[model samples]
Target: MTPSTWSPAQPPAWFEQARHLAAVRRYQLAEELTRRELAQNPRSPLAFVVLSMLLWQQARYDEAEAAARDALAVQPTYDEAFYFLALSCASQGRSAEARAAIHTAIELDPASAKYYALRSRFELEWHYAAQSRATAEEGLRVEPTNLECLHRRLLALRQLSETSLAEETARNMLALDPECAPAHLALGELLLSQADYVTAEAYFRAALRQQPGLAAARQGLSESWKQRYWLSRRLARLDAWVARAGQWLTARGLGGHLVLLLGFVLVVPVVCLPLCLAYGWSYLRWRLAPAILLVRGRPLGQPCWQCWYRLICPAWRWPWGCWRPTASGARYGASRRPNQSAIT
Candidate 1:
């Protein structure tokens, strides 16, 4: 049909296809189709609105806002076009412009629960908890069971520190959808803030069981385990300290020396004492044989003096050797050798 003959009653096939593709999230194909439709009917305001929405979904905010303005130029009363412009403006951090645009959209279509929900979310993003709560309540008044409004209300209450009310809202959401990950996570966070790690962990685990890839639930679960036991918390801190200390030592080339020192100090005491005693007794038996024969031409059972000296000396040396700064002294000596050579 000719452009002049076209009307909403006989919408183009391409426009229908574009809308369908957009609904199915096939944005690229839908965008191509919408542009083709717009090329044939430049004056079609709905086509411009659809193109704006397509651009908005693609995160081309400036282009989407321009396209939305074009839609408004063609049909000044298009509420959906204003809504798209608001969303585009919001994406670009134009909060005042977004609020004005969304207000215009709501004035054009006051009964739209989705618009109310969107406005409520915008308020929440802008940190206007009171306004967000009011907007969400307005939406709920219109549609009592709207999930978007319900979630927004829950978030606004939490932001306002209305803990009991937020918990009630969360429970209501769970009552509506038992497998809702956000509801479970909300309850978990509430409990966690109260230091009820055991109960919080259960809710966080439930959220994960419902939705395994939920990052908030995963983080909450990890935190729950860390704070669940005193020992775990202390160990976690110690591990963090050790990691930082290792990094600090490695930067100064002392990491390897520190490891060796710790092994010698802690491990040698436990292991070397037994091995040293065994070696001392064997060596004394062999050494005393020659000494006894030389002294009286008799076979010696054992030499107590040699045994005591060998055992005591090695044990003494083990700790004294560890205490001595052999590694540090070598590092110091090597560092000074170059300077000493230069001076000589």
Candidate 2:
């Protein structure tokens, strides 16, 4: 068809509804509505962009990329098309293309903090911590109250080990949003690293109070307690070792024992104490650590490690009893007889 003959088809009301739904973050319903609309007008760029966003939200990156390409082919300069194209490319490890597309988006809308935020996100995805921090900082300079910009800056600072800056940014974020769980968790981790156990515990507790399922905050709290416990134990052990060495020096009449005692009390605790404490900490973690996940506030009954391993390396269920249970009424009964279990 000639370019003049390429009349853009009018999208149905359902297509508009789907766009609204996607805008409001109701992705599943948007996907269904977009599918229905696409059935009627398959070549509509609007339809394709909506479908692309839905697939992107669901993390179907390859499908999202194809849909974005379809939209871009119909309307090459469409901003939303380019935006979703960048997202799909980023999701699938096409960082160079994603970066170029994001740059184009920013060029198209230089004043948009959302575009800068996307740039920061792509930098983070590529593990360019310093570049991500700069991008986020620039975005925040333009839009001072932008939550995404502040969050990105905080995360990048944390990753780069810029402790003071990260803590400051996290505190600012918390001041803006007291219920921000990640900010609280980040501040807690920073304090924990600095050996500020009491303050770290308070931050972690606050995070848990806001979001009980925040595993990072819970982990920070656990680590803070372990640190204090280990420090106390190490000091006690060093004192005992020193007392024993002093008695040895008195009995053997050797001045070397005093030196040895000093070395053991000072150097050994400096070096060996951390290692010993780490081992004990890990032992306690293995023994008393809570389950990594919970369902309805109860510990997950299924063995996640075994399930994850099975998922990674699939094997015939008939050869091994590795069938998983379903929440539905389908009972996955154990295979009693030989070759009775169906392969998953």
Candidate 3:
């Protein structure tokens, strides 16, 4: 078909193939197919959108945003293009632009529960917990059983200190999909905060069983182990108390920026001195952790990634700060990115 004579009202076979490949995470092959399709049909907005998705998967956020923009230029009403643009911009730390783009997308496709779910996650990640919860509720209104929205709602609830609601949301998620690692991880975090280390440890272990590479789950497992000891538990309690105090300051209608400022001026002055002394004790304990484990005849605690003993520890299951190993001995993509989503 000639360029001017043809419209991409129906995507070509290659476009479908590329979409399937991208869904299956065969990014390089999907990218190649998408590029070829775009070359043949330069005006195809959907082709550009696929290219944007491919680039985003590769973490080439600038290129991804450009491709999304190209899609928008080709078809001004392409909501998926705007959604991809928002994701790319978010990845690049252009938060305001990303929010605007996502708002456009949501306005264009109000029925798309995924858009609201994504927005909820964006809000939570950016520290707007109340807004995040609202967004998640919007998603749930569109699709009551949406797991993504439920998980984000759970997280937002936790952040807002609505523990009862958060636990109920987590139970709903587990009821929906027992294998959902994110739900398990959230529940584990909740239990950890409540000082229920044994139960939290089980949940963390379940999360890891479902997704071994989940950084947050691994970290939670290590934390649960640390708190099994009385001395470390006391230190952890002190840290949690300080954090709660900061939250109390933040709740008094302080500006978001002032929360940290007041935390430094008010909460930290009273808390951090003792916290620092506790940290000194923590450092000494961290150094002696191996000896303590040996004395207890327990190697269950993961060797601290930063500890000097990690290189020599038999219990070190994975590389430092990584759950997987690559040919280079460091995990590929092992820049310690936050385990944002629990799907591995």
Candidate 4:
């Protein structure tokens, strides 16, 4: 079976009991097994690595990092140990350290698709969409059937707003694995971006059917429902029509629109000039009237020009605060999508 579809019953024989315990989230028992293995063979890198994974499963990142380091000390060339160390560091928000460790892991085992996918995820988190896509593409080159790499590439393209390319990639993913939940969710998000609420909703529903507990798919479904409401749907249709009209006009060249704008400007000047004149007169009267109240015809404190400047040029600010944008925290369950190579 492929790595993504790994079953708990699969036999590696060496760490059979430990792996089974960890798979079932029995981290305490898994730790005991690893401890026994280490007692039997103190210099065994695999035992230390298992201990690291068990600690990682319990969110004990610092302890996990130490265990991974111990594994590396026992076997300097342990790529999987380095991979787990990177994951532990990343979970603790030490991104720079995490990136460095992940890079070292990749350098040691460039053929491992999981390393490349993790690197891509880091790049994307750092807002390096192009680099993320390149890394995922490299992973795909190494393992053409790797679903995680494909999904990472799709996500990177979406971040870059390369919608057409993202759509093609999503379609390719579905072709590779029709039952893949992430592929369905990716397609749903792509369609949602294009304002195809009806189709997007269907894709999200399909994803939910495949993986009922998928957080991202459920969040996508909620957003699709919000967009599919009657008023939002009507507004979306109008927006689409306007977009089509704009495209048609552009295809015909800019001259037509320029002529239309010219006509509007000419007509507005005639109607607006008199009103402007009247308003200007009233403003002058108001300002002079204020000055008349000043002693010895001296002007008031200030012209209040600052008020006008503020009105003309409002303060620069974002609608939201300076926080990184994120999806509705759609985390795949830790148990279902085990970070096997990277941590487990």
Error of 1 at 31 (Å): 1.3
- How would you order the candidates by lDDT, starting with the best? 3, 1, 4, 2
TM-score of each: 0.60, 0.58, 0.63, 0.63
**Can you list the residue pairs that collide in candidate 1?**
none
**After superposing candidate 3, which stretches have Cα over 4 Å from the reference?**
1-16, 234-344
What are the runs in model 2 whose C-alpha is more than 4 Å off?
A: 1-27, 40-44, 209-212, 231-344
lDDT string for model 1 (108-172, tens) is 98987777888999999989999999999998898877777889999999999999999999998
Ranking of models by TM-score: 3, 4, 1, 2
lDDT of each: 0.80, 0.76, 0.81, 0.79
Per-residue lDDT tens digits for candidate 2, residues 145-198, read 877788889889888988898989998988889988888888899998898999
- Per-residue lDDT tens digits for candidate 3, residues 165-209, read 999999899999999899899999999989899999999999999
The sequence of per-residue lDDT tens digits that candidate 4 reaches over residues 1-344 is 12112223344465887777776777798788789878989998877877887788788999999999999999989888888898899989999999999999999989889889989988998899999999999999999988788889999999998989888888898998898888899899889878798999999999999999999999988988988778877887899999997887788678868876898999999989999999999986654432233222222342455334323432243222112133764221112343468993
Find the candidate with the highest lDDT and give its number: 3
RMSD of each: 17.5, 28.6, 26.0, 27.4
Clashing pairs in 4: none
* Candidate number that wins on TM-score, 1 or 2: 1
